[model samples]
Target: MKIYSLSKIAIVLSVLLIFILLGALWRVSAVPQTSLIVQDEQFFEVKPGANMTSVLRELAEKEVIEPSFWQSVWIKSNPKLANIQQGWYQLSIGMTLLNFVQKLHVGHVVEHKITLVEGFTVWQWLEQMAATGDIIIDVSYDHDAFEYQFTPLSKHHQMTIREGYFAPDTYAYAHQAKASDILFAAYAKQRQQLKALMSEFTLPKFIHNEHELLTLASIVEKETGTAKERPIIAGVFLSRLAKNMRLQTDPTIIYGIGPSFNGDITYADLRAKTPYNTYRINGLTPTPIANPSLASIKAVLAPEQTDALYFVARGDGTHEFSKTLAAHNKAVKKYQLTKP
Candidate 1:
């Protein structure tokens, strides 16, 4: 009778031990099964000072994971919950709980999606670049500094970073990246693209060097923002360049006046005697007014074969291209007239 009692007790204890082992194994298996969560295509920012519960709540709020209670329970049960790592994580939609935990434990942060669009002036880009956190491009870094450093390169037969010379692309970058490095990368990409396109073009007698072409492309980019108008604008500038006439691009005047120049181009701003003022310079500015798109670059390389020598904005994000001064004057009067 005593032996029988002993056997029953042993069996009960054995079953309890098995259950405990299974629970431990289950937790271990779950550590790697967390799914990635993405909300509205934005990565969650797991900043500093976020605790395990707060992180879970943030995940829940972002719709990357389920309700807070579930995550809270899971995190509490996990042995490695003390190692809640923080950074900008690129969580996907429908991420599992375990994978999410692992990501935090590993401290994986998503890079910033820095999109430098075409037609942004250097000063405008500098402001946007500064807005991103931990970026080191000081607003105090003078434009003259960049120009002075690059002028020597131009003398060495190398192209400098000028308007329309940087590639317009969405680049993935760390938050800690330097501003100068970002600008340099964009310029390098532009050079690579230019080299490939330059091989394709058989230029005429008038267009001699790469700088002249890039200068013309920058003017085309500034004259019209619409893609459809780029080619026609390029023709007008190319024609003007051929005739030794002033490009008279308004963007150049804005560039001359610096960041103080608002979008409004005043008559006095046009008459400004700065080197960047196309009205005064009678040709392309020493630097580009803004970063031109690839379409503008290609337009300069393969300009539309036309006799257009003038263009004026229609205030509708398009341009009126003309072959004669009379025709251009008529367009200006029709489009530039103010409605009281």
Candidate 2:
């Protein structure tokens, strides 16, 4: 009877030991091995006021970590989860648990990408800037207000960074970036590129200032998307400018209408009196209509030597170039008036 009692106690103790061992093993496996999160492509921004528990929740939600079990053990074992710092860090594969924890404690953060596509207006770019949420800037499509506010800056430096002055390109911004920082970055990039491009070509004879050059480049950008077409479009605008004829560019009319552009251009809208109405106002608009691409800038700086005075869209993504009003009317009739 005593031997039977000893065997029963021994079995119970052995089972208890096995359970304890398993628990230890599970905890060790739960601890992260790498500092990098392999789950999501975007940089996970752990905002201010986010605690260890909240961060763990985000990690689990993104499948970066194995949910709550490890966190529970970590909290129980560690003294207040240590001091986790906030910053960008590269996530590497196979980082060890203590190292990963140490990274959080050190708080090394990483930067993310913000891409600005070509042909985007200032208003459109502002919307994109606002969407980042990391940056603080008031987005306004108000033409008069924005133009008036930045006119001095544009005029003083002959800087094009006011309206269509910022180049459209992919930019990297830190998680803590602000709107002005992003805008300034783009403006700086344009300045560098413009300087380099200026070295390669002579400025147009009619353009006395850098602002005028940028204004013409912006018009070229709006008129055509094809790189080959930019020079031709530039030529047409140049010819009109020389003739003292109104630019009459539709994009300028669209800009004047602001957000009311309903994908339809009306005759009355074209004749509407506004500062940006190129049809009524001779030469380029009071300000650039949209940001010009580098290709358009190059086209303006070194335009094709042509007497072409007009062009109409060829229904395709191309344009029909002409040298006279008669030729322009013919092309317009064939391309715009004729039904497909």
Candidate 3:
């Protein structure tokens, strides 16, 4: 070899580096176009315990991509990216082969959404959760199962059943995610939120702990149609609890009736005595009738200073609050009865 000066050697090396960069660009650009790769399926599932080599082979077998020997060599060179994550990967209509590979490399798996709505019972949530596809549920949904899932939370509060323990919100999870994990997440979130609320506000005798707070908040959640009305509704329930008046919230009776409720609340249902029928029971329900939102929970802690002891629906998904039964009955007559 001929001896070269440092400047000339640097120039030669720079030229070779440019050529290598171009080759690397070509390596990726030469792959398949940005198509969904979903000729017959919408998702590509990478089974658990699969390695990068096996995943590449599966992709090649499907004709999604055929990594040439050089490309394979390049992949092997990146040892950090040698393992593929496990989950179902969604292939959009405009996804490219490189985009798909990047998703597989980074564990950007397909995400499924589930909503735990406020004022809906745990049983309803389980029904919705269990009905979802690709969401794993290893255990049955029963009293014992719910108790087991809520044991961590029940250490402090009496959650004999996993009722108002779950925080109401929309959650996203990858395919093969456990439903129980989501359940615990919701529970843990509620615990954190309740703790925060308790720390923020001083509790009254009527509201003893997180369990009682959620119990009253669930009633408040069901009582109001408008979000702004939560504080007022919460105020009415708290006032009633303070004065030894029965809660008499219709939602409690509906919950007590369970699946037999036919979208109508009759006098008989109000008269029926159950642990949840606040019209018949004293003070708060033994447990939450349904999952309440944080707003409802906060509404209980920092209730609107009002003497309103009752509220009636205003026919337009609003409420008319009153300090006395006379005003409440008038509101009921105007809104609940026919437009006279």
Candidate 4:
């Protein structure tokens, strides 16, 4: 009789403990979580293939959430709603467990912005973009690697790094994005825009293909003294090309000198026989010196109607357009020589 009575008491005690545990779990589910002590600016990264259990354990250790095995159980019970997406998630205090789970499941990943400026070299562009520190730079900034990785605009197009193919604009990217991702995005946008614009305007005889047009646009982009002067500069370059005259643009010479070049450009640098020296070469540089803006690109396709074949910067951020070399020289003497 004593042994039977002891067994009944043990069963009752086990049932009571089970009820207590269930009640605790019910409170955890119904109540808002306050264990999170992480700052508003803090972010938790949920990597690919990460499970909720391990993530909850990690959060507990980090004090981002209270330690509870039942929370993971709660997640497992509702697998559909608890499925977290992979990316950076901003963590904050006073968030319920459901709120946390739903936020990750819905994929509210943090994003960063990068702006590629007009007339920036490919190297400059990459360096500036990498400043975000979350991007993966798998490929080096070179023609061989980029060409092999990305598809050409057309089968006839030769893929090159210095082709001025990537568009200049502010791009938004998630954390841990690849450098090639940004490159491909910019290239795709630029390619699409170029295609649409090409249909609107016809290339001159001197400009053979899209490559030549981009090359001219890059020159026009760099030579532009002001936003309003882009069309005029483009016209002047087109007139020079039509007249069989050398472009004689300074930006190309500076590009030929490479990154080691200081701000100053000497007569020797101008006379240098580099492939990019338009002053010495009879036509456009072998490749674009820098990326061009949309305005510059548009200006090249539909150049302003003007007889002006030359332009000289007038000390300030403006230029003096001249139809004759004598007038150009006079403006240069007035602007370049006499400026303090």
**What overall lDDT goes with each candidate model?**
0.70, 0.74, 0.75, 0.79
Poorest 10 consecutive residues by lDDT, candidate 3: 150-159
Look at candidate 4 and give me any clashing residue pairs: none
Stretches off by above 4 angstroms in model 3 are: 1-37, 57-81, 93-97, 130-132, 137-161
Q: Write the per-residue lDDT of candidate 2 for residues 1-340, one digit (tens) a residue.
A: 9999999999999999999989977765667543545743445666677767777777778777766566656755775556676665555665544655666776767666888777778777767877776655533345554451323222222333367768889988777565556667777888898899878877887776667888888888878956788887888888788889888888888877876689898988877888788888877776777788888888888888898888889877899888888999999999999966
Between the candidate structures 3 and 4, which one is better when assessed by lDDT?
A: 4
Model 1 TM-score (2 dp): 0.66
Runs with alpha carbons beyond 4 Å of true place in candidate 4: 1-22, 30-32, 61-63, 93-96, 142-160
**Candidate whose lDDT is highest:** 4
Among all candidates shown, the one with the greatest TM-score: 4
Q: Cα deviation of 34 in candidate 4 (Å)? A: 3.6
Q: Write the per-residue lDDT of candidate 4 for residues 36-136, one digit (tens) a residue.
A: 66667677888888877777887888887778667766776677866778888777666666677778878878888889888887777767867767776
lDDT value for model 3: 0.75
lDDT of candidate 1 at residue 277, scale 0 to 100: 81
Arranged by TM-score, best first: 4, 3, 2, 1
lDDT of 1 by residue, 1-340 (tens): 9999999999999999999888766755654465645544455666788887787777677666656444555666675854866666655667666666677788766667678877877666768878876565632324653341222322322433445567778876665556666677788998998898889876544667776677667777777768887877777777777788988887777767776766788878777788888887776777666777888888877777788888778877878888899998999888887534
Query: Each model's TM-score?
Result: 0.66, 0.71, 0.76, 0.85
What ranges in model 1 sit over 4 Å off?
1-109, 134-141, 144-163
Weakest ten-residue segment in model 2 by summed lDDT: 148-157
Off by over 4 Å in 2: 1-85, 88-110, 130-137, 146-161
Evaluated against the true structure, the overall lDDT of model 1 is 0.70
